[model samples]
Target: MSLSDCRILELPRISDPRGNLTFIESDNHIPFGIDRVYYLYDVPGGAERGGHAHKQLHQLIIAASGSFSVMLDDGTERRTFFLNRSNYGLYICPMIWRELHDFSSGSVCMVLASRKYEEEDYYRDYAEFQEAAEKRG
Candidate 1:
């Protein structure tokens, strides 16, 4: 899919004077069914992660604790999203390259994936990802 397919989603939030709560339901708040869930935390300063693309996986990435930036590339164009709110998330479509960087200390990145982890589904090489994206087009 193209870069236009990617979007930001606002999750349900319940505001309380004591604290706030955010929740997501499969195929309700997200476009796809949830098959796997993962999170990244305690990332050291200046470290980067997620330098790859998935062939058939859809992901909803949220900043559950602190802040971080998600750089997205769809073979032709590139964009960056800064995530710091628990009520917001970035929806990444398949066949796009993504990188997570500039993670603040104690940042927790929660990822809701549409499918289980499959090594074969990942394209880690930028050139290979571009070629694969071209083939998909």
Candidate 2:
């Protein structure tokens, strides 16, 4: 749940004269099994996303196009990462407070989640997240 627990996964890049390709598969580059894939788009400046934390699900986030950044906080520790390439990803463990920001124009962020959509699995407030994380200790 700390910044130290988060990791950057360098995905394999297949270079071609025309273009480059990258991919992430379950039981491979991703630490957790992938069950869902979603992308964020059309984010204007001064807007933010992912102001929440999951209780159990893990996520592998990629900047599929353009660039973006994520601010990670685990109640005590904080770290920020700029994701600007398609061949890289950020692996976020459970109980980490994450906020996605600074999206470049036409940027698209893809997230591979370990679990399907479950409202109960989400902690939408920092105070609530802290309480749950504390209880887990």
**Model 2 over residues 70-110: C-alpha lDDT tens digits?**
99988778899999989999999999999999999899999
Clashing pairs in 1: none
- lDDT of each residue in 1-137, candidate 1, tens digit only: 88899999999999999999998999999999999999999999999999999999999999999999999999999999999999999999999899999999999999999999999999999999999888888
Best by lDDT: 1
**All candidates' TM-scores?**
0.98, 0.96
Clashing pairs counted in every model? 0, 0
Which residue runs does candidate 2 get wrong by more than 4 Å?
none
Query: What local lDDT score does residue 105 receive in model 2, on the 0 to 100 scale?
Result: 87
lDDT of 2 at 49: 92
Best by TM-score: 1
